[model samples]
Target: MESQQEIKVIKSSGKRAKFSLTKLRSSLKRCGADDHMIDKIVNSVRDELYQGISTKEIYNRAYAMLKKEKHVYASKYKLKKAIYELGPTGFPFEKFVSTILNYSGYKVVLDQQVEGKCVTHEIDVVATKNEKQILVECKFHSEEGRNCDVKIPLYIHSRFQDILLQSTAEETKPQECWVVTNTRFTKDALQYGSCVGLYLLSWDYPINDGLKDRIDRLGLYPITVLSLLSNREKQFLLSRNVVPCRQLIGDQFYLDHLGVSQERQEKIMTEINLLANL
Candidate 1:
């Protein structure tokens, strides 16, 4: 048991907390790591521990160690931070949502303005699967601690109702509404959603069926998770709408256009191949 004075980690929120090997080990386990791999990576991270280390630094170390052991698990290990890197704004998040929905057998329309009974509302995404139509609102928070609250559900419910009222029977066929976020939902928000039958998808809500689960089930990771890229590079790629590593797999022209140096570009492609198993 290391005391708080022994080691500290700077969190993504810019807050500091005492480093705990237990917590790190638990996180690896949650990422579906096996016992043997978990022990090895935990020991590796422990050996490199120091006071005032950034959580990102600790994570990268663990990720590198884990990647050598199991590439898929290593990719999943960075899920949380990868999600955070999806935004300073929610556009990338929306694109991610679209991708997930598309993968899930839904035809998706992004950032469309649909006419409600009273007004025209700019819907974040519209996903239609078979005969079921889903209106999706993606609520993305850049920071970890903040969550989607009751007010958001209430607001979305109103818009959903408005859309339901305005649309023809054919247009609203088997309609549903979903609010998805990269973080968790507030207690009240979850409660409200349950009461209203509004589908809510967050990072860890609904047990094994949350956003992370859905992403992992399909192995549809965002481009931000590429460990070889820096924050600035990731953001730049996102800004240009290059939001999936698969998009860069064989596209050397795009890499060159982005001005990624030849050596670094090779490193990135190699990493993407490992993560995507391409």
Candidate 2:
């Protein structure tokens, strides 16, 4: 049966878009939901649809059904949401980005101050490998539907230029400056970044080499994505600087810190290892 309803739905950005079945299928598939489950969830979700339905509710319903089928799938489905949980502070997000780069074999430094031509600039992450250095700025948003606008890259690039100038004046190799976000970028932001030679990376930019791609490539799912973990427990792990699920690998001691029962730890470990599968 097809839904007879047609309505503009609200997005996390508060923008309205026509409901898309293809989009629903793609997202469910991307999260490892099979055809049968996707149909069930989509049909269930569509039946609940009304004028001005928020995508958040659609996702919640789909996720609830997905989790009911397989908890691991729920973990995979919440990757974007997990990124959001990385902050009200950008510290954990910077570390999260640094950890991702580190897995790709880069040496990373976090929260360092480097001198620019005009003044000192506090860089979020400094990554070096094979004598090439890259300065990364991480912008984290706690809420969904936020984007890195052109003004962001414009501001960061000016500081990068100043730093680059000073580094060049010192007769040393200069660094590349990059702005990274846990969300998407506006069209103007992408244009400004490319036009200025400032590298920009976000949830799904730069073609196949965006933040989400890298995480999937490395199985570096964050601890926040653990479905069974409470928000308090997740925050506790983040406070201790334990970000990636891989970090807790073979270290049952951290589970001890959370007071997880030995039996519960085993189940949690099972979910953690499932994330590493791809």
Candidate 3:
């Protein structure tokens, strides 16, 4: 085992922390690397590990190494970047959110308008499961270090109040409001959300059940993560709101539409299948 004290790594937040070999191994394993591959990759990464290295560099090194062994796992490892590439606009991210809700057994409607007492509020996503309904506001950030602040929850809560007032006037049950972000919430935002009974889902919040966790748990990775797919190809698919990798499993028409050749399509399918099995 490499001594953690021997190396310090810079985080996305610009904080320095002791390097963790366990975390390095776990990250690869989570992306469906086999035990043998994990061991090999870790040993390779360990040799390259040094003080003052940025996490981004470390990730790139590991991803490049993984790509040599298995393109599918390499693609799976790019979850964070894949998600960021979802948009400069939050529209695609909202669709991704809806997909997650659908996978969790909710019937989802995107960009829906609900009549509030004052005016109609356009909700990013509205999901219903069983007897419960949730109105979600999706906040997406393409860059790291951007957090959803308390103002978002506060504004959302105000809108919910108007919605509740309208619902009460019509004798309808009020829908619960949730704040979902692709990144994370500020400390004050989380505190305010909890105090007001607002549900929040962010990249790493909620511990074992955060947005990233849920995606990994379902193996519902975005097709953009496929290493074989060029950025332009991925953007072409994303332009049409095609997000999930599994959606391409048997959809040759869509593959052709995205301009993927027969040869490339076969490779894409192979990777997709490998990811699904993982």
> Candidates' TM-scores?
0.81, 0.94, 0.92
For lDDT, candidate 2 versus 3, the one ahead is 2
* Candidate 1 local lDDT, 1-278, one digit each (tens): 35444888888668789998888888899666889988988777877777778898988888888778765567678888788888888999999889889988999999988888999989999899887889899999987768788999999999988888888777564379999999888899999999999999999888989987887677677888776667777777788887767777755667787688999888777767655545
Q: Rate the local accuracy (lDDT) of all candidates.
A: 0.83, 0.88, 0.85
lDDT of 2 by residue, 64-156 (tens): 998899988899888999999988898989999999989999999999999988999999999988888898999898989988899999999
Location of the lowest summed lDDT over 10 successive residues in candidate 3: 166-175
Ranking by TM-score: 2, 3, 1
Residues 1-278, candidate 3: write the lDDT tens digits.
Answer: 44656788998778888889898888898888999999988887788777788999989988998899889789878888889989888888898889989988999999988998899999999888876888999999988767899999999999998889788543255558989998889899999999999999998889999987998888788887899988888888888778888777756578888677899888888888777674
User: How far off is residue 8 in model 3, in Å?
Assistant: 2.5
Ranking of all candidate structures by their lDDT, best first: 2, 3, 1
Worst-scoring 10-residue span by lDDT in model 2: 167-176
Q: Which residue ranges in model 1 land beyond 4 Å of their true spot?
A: 1-23, 29-34, 44-75, 171-174, 261-266
